[model samples]
Target chain A: MSTRSPTPVFLDTLRHVETPEGIELSLRVAGPVARVLAWSMDSLIRYGALWVLLMVLAMLGEGGMGLWLIALFLTEWFYPALFEVYAGGATPGKKALGLKVIHANGTPVDWPGALIRNLLRAVDFLPLLYGFGLVAMLCNRNFQRLGDLAAGTMVIYRDPAAAMPQLPPGRALPPPFPLNTAEQQLLIDFAERSTTLNPERQAELADLLARQTGLYGVAGVERLCAHARWLAGEPT
Target chain B: MPLETIAAELRRRNAWEATDLGMVMVRQWLGSIYAAWFTVALPLFMLLHLVCWGHWWLAPWLMWWLKPLLDRPPLYILSYALFGDPPDRRQFWRALPGLLLRRQAFAALTWRRLDVARSFTLPVTQLEGLAGKVRRQRLRDLSYPSRGAAIWLTVVGLHLEIALDFALIALVWMLTPDFIALEFFDLLDDSSQWGQLWLNVVGFCGLSLVEPFYVAAGFTLYLNRRAWLEAWDLELGFRKMAARLAPAGRVAAGLAMLALGLGLLMIPLENFAAEAPSRSNPPPPAIEESLMNPLCEQRRVREVELAQAGSSIKQALAETLKEPELHVCQVQERWRWRDDNSTESPPRSPPDPRPGQWFAATIELLLWLAVGLFIAVAGWWLWRRTPRAFTRARQRAAQSGPRLVQGRNEITIPPDAGLGDTAWRLWTEGQPREALRLLYQGSLAGLAAQHGLPVRSSATEDDCLRLAVAQLANPELLGFLRRLTRAWQAIAYAHRIPDEADARSLCLEWPRHFAAAGALPA
Candidate 1:
């Protein structure tokens, strides 16, 4: 994954992790807003759970409050840690939001990391609410809280990808200039993404090369299409 | 799949947003064509579903939930139309079975958009031919920004739907007969009987009205994001330019034709060899060497300027220092027998004159001077270690994170009057920040002026705080200074206003702490 410093704040980055098997994995770190929503989900779950615990343990009278206190302590502290360490690095709330916690190295977070992050919530809570935590998150690229920073972990989306649509049918045409790998990739990129872009835009973009192509307007776009077709191994 | 989605974005990108006129154009182009087909299918699906399941609400949900499946033909239709390919409605039907058989079943069930990325979702998968982890990575990359757009677009669509629906209902109420209007209100009053029915009807209508723009927006975001990541704009521009450049095109064509022509000029090797069979070796040509020498230009000049070897920097430095004529002496404690053992002191033993003793004394004097300078430097370095070193030690005790510590260079502050009184006075005079600045500056100055603490000019407020906290002997004073620094930093940098009471208390409390900050070297 490219470290997206100096890139726009809006653009969420993909962390490219090469697994032990040598396969590259892209972990898309979730932003602050998404994490907040996930945290809300987890909190909601915790509320309902404690409510149930209160009703169920009502049977034991005075002793139940003691049990409830213990349960509350466990639920508040251990709930997130256990889920993060054991349940594939996510609480139910995070899972619902399609978020997972992982080490900065893209490995699964260990117990220490999970514990440190959760424990720091008290400190991260700061003078009022999660003031420090929020500031830390906004400043950090990965939306990491003080806990995540201390623990060396990041939260990312676990979304799967859909297959790409088939390329548009066209006859291949040879390019007018020699291209390196990056330039060649651009041609394929245009073809792949052209379906999502407007034709007027495609033409306008194609027109930018009047200085180089000598061809103006429609011819340039047509030429680009031909080059794209050729790049994709379509019929000449 | 949907070229208009890409086309629309190109339009939008070309002209930032003309009140979303491009969106209107795109919707007019793609939405009108697709919605007609969607409308035609809706009644038939409704009738069939009503007979099977007995709920008309299921039809629109089915229409929406089956959007991923439904989008395929329309995408093809839009793509073809954009490319000027012949439109074939029959092809849409023909491809239906293939789409059903091959497409991701789970993607059709992306009920909520959060799951949109999780469902192996969208035109990216269908269009890009990537599968498994690679596709997943792309989807993961696109999800955040796309979801953001999707959310905004959905809101817009819903608002548009509400406006349109409200206008339609109002127009109907105004134009239609009075009896129907009364009946509609009566039906609304009986919410239990007609509530779910009205909800389904309104919801479906709203959804149908919004779905086109929503889908278009989503597709545009997805495609545009890919374009951005892949730099499609640059590539297409270059390819088009390169086409006109003809870097290898017409020349290669000409070369191909030339090669064909050259083939006709080839001789039959066997026949040529037999016709001219007589072989002879030629003698070597005689070599003639020329004896002429090349002419060269030359210029005459006076003697080159040079410095005398003895006149160097070393001698100059010696001359500048001006070595002083000095003598060294050795004094020994000498005991002499006192005859009377009286209080009268005997004459102090003086060094006896010895040859070459003056030279030895000079060398020894130089050695002593060197030792004195070293001692001074060592004392200064030791003195420089203050509270800042302690703060660093405390912070870096065990697993001290290797932070790129900012501002290591210390600054020298001019110790003004009393640090505490000056800070308190400045703070009370409504210059709170300046007050804190004075306190920090005074404390630093006190460190240097009183205790010989070395300070670099580059040190920030934080550096001063850490240094003060680590160096100060008293805990109460240290804590007080820490709070003062924290408050000052908040106000100075973050623009936070400390509570008047807090500020007042701190102002009053600072001098006491400032007094304690005057640490002396051990």
Candidate 2:
């Protein structure tokens, strides 16, 4: 009798757990650098948009005073308020940052959370600039600033697309059984250079296996043929 | 089942609607409407300021009334784009829930919250306390990633609109017959020539303004349509239904929130707008006017220089304080507090400082201390009690796993195990992924097992092998294992599954050779 370790079972369970109870998201872990870059880009775009607008407006008025005045007001209140109420972000900056305002249980961000986070932007600002905020992020696990702590919100990255690797050619091996063209090709191609094989040795071995595996062989690489035919039993 | 059924299922399993463009558009329109509204309010505010300053005569002549209406066209366009033809306020309100629950949108919100949280000088203790609350799932909803994205989108929209508005005003000034006449009409006194020139300039400016607006409106409409098609409304309706059917307390809370929202909406209209006259009398200061003007004109240049210098100093100070030395501190204190002279010191216990007095005193003492006895003892104590440290340790422990050799091209399979056991073990040891790769290529018993639907209890090696060869549409794996077919034939016919060692060896060797099992010529 053999006892099974529950580790695989747990991991399998975790994989299938797209969403936890009461939450609406599939639980997928992402790389930290990717998450940070996505967020930074989002913020830059949003704040940059506002800044550009202000610059244009300023260019229009007497020495751009009107634009500057509006920009100042916007940096403080307008950015967050408009996003929170309509798009549920501080501004396009926050939104682009791949961040959202939500309730504690993964619901839409309420007005209080929005207000608290925006208001605490002053505290997160700290001794000089967002230095305090940076420190907070460094110290905290989720990289939350003071405003985020107050607001109870977080920043996370979204999913990207997927791709697969192609197989290499193989060496000649004796065929063990009958084989189809596709199966023969698959075996010949894949077993060409096992990771264990040295680069210099790979081509020589692959040619040998290919001949035996039915790619170019006599007795038609019986072992290779047999393996290819048996392997066909599994899904592609 | 037909291939269509399989394809449909696969598509559904893999599908996720792209929401980026839609989110971007909605945020842009929201920003536009808000910015336009703000613009309209500016002149009104200015007029109100002048009225309080007893410059009431200037208000009417300055065309303050037109300020509010200036934003109308943009607002109308935005409203139409967001809500569609024959826009309904009720439907808009109803759709709010759906919009709120959107997955991508919600992800953006969480990102926004994390960005916001980084700004404060929150003591490590307090921050940890908050983090505890957050990680406990108490604060999950409040921290969505998409909040940041949506906000930034709005910011962009606002900027675009502001630029448009500025261009509008500049165009307006440039096109006015009076201004044109003042600047150029004198140069060419012919009325028809002046009119024609003015018409051409106006036409050009009109085209510029109309293009951005149309683009913006179209973008917003596209996003709204996409959002609608995603069935966000249905999702929200289901959630609402679930909440309604839940316990009475949740139902009551939901109702209360609705009532509160309704009341809040009414408060501003009822209180402020109704008493407009009283409010109008005591207007806010002339912020824009003063901001635009140089106070005490004689010293304007000197003042500007001084202000610029001051701002630079402020910026420098802000930047300096943001440096890491101010916040990040390493923990390396060993004191007699936890088993004196012990190589691995036990966790420290925090000092019981006198209430309300420790803040300034401890900060200074801690900053000044350098391996001093008192500080060491205190630091060790503090480290022990620090929730941050505890949380870090806990997390580290949770993530502990078998150490795999890093940067290796080849994975080593464990020896001495049955095939199934080996696969399971490899998976636990971070090699299951490699095994899965093998499985993807082709596995003899696995394919046969899938096809034959063998009895769970009676899966002899022979039975598995026969199924692999006879039942499977494809038998690459069985062919690969044909070297052992003679041996397996006896086991299957004899009604006996291979014992632990044979199975284990097969499992171990399988992944190393699995890739070659399913290759096909292009």
> Which run of 10 residues does model 2 chain B get worst, by summed lDDT?
B7-16
Off by over 4 Å in 1: A1-28, A59-68, A172-181, A209-223, A229-236, B1-522
Q: Write the per-residue lDDT of candidate 1 for residues B101-195, one digit (tens) a residue.
A: 46554544543333433212456655565667896787777665555545544444455555444443443445667656454354334244254
Per-residue lDDT of A34 in model 2:
26
- lDDT score of residue B235 within candidate 2: 27
Best by DockQ: 1
Overall lDDT per candidate, in order of appearance: 0.56, 0.40
Candidate 2 local distance difference test against the native: 0.40
In Å, residue B9's CA in model 1 sits off its true spot by: 18
TM-score list, all predictions: 0.32, 0.21
DockQ of candidate 1 relative to the true structure: 0.04
Please give the DockQ score of every candidate, comma-separated. Answer: 0.04, 0.01
Which of the numbered candidates is closest to the native, going by highest TM-score? 1
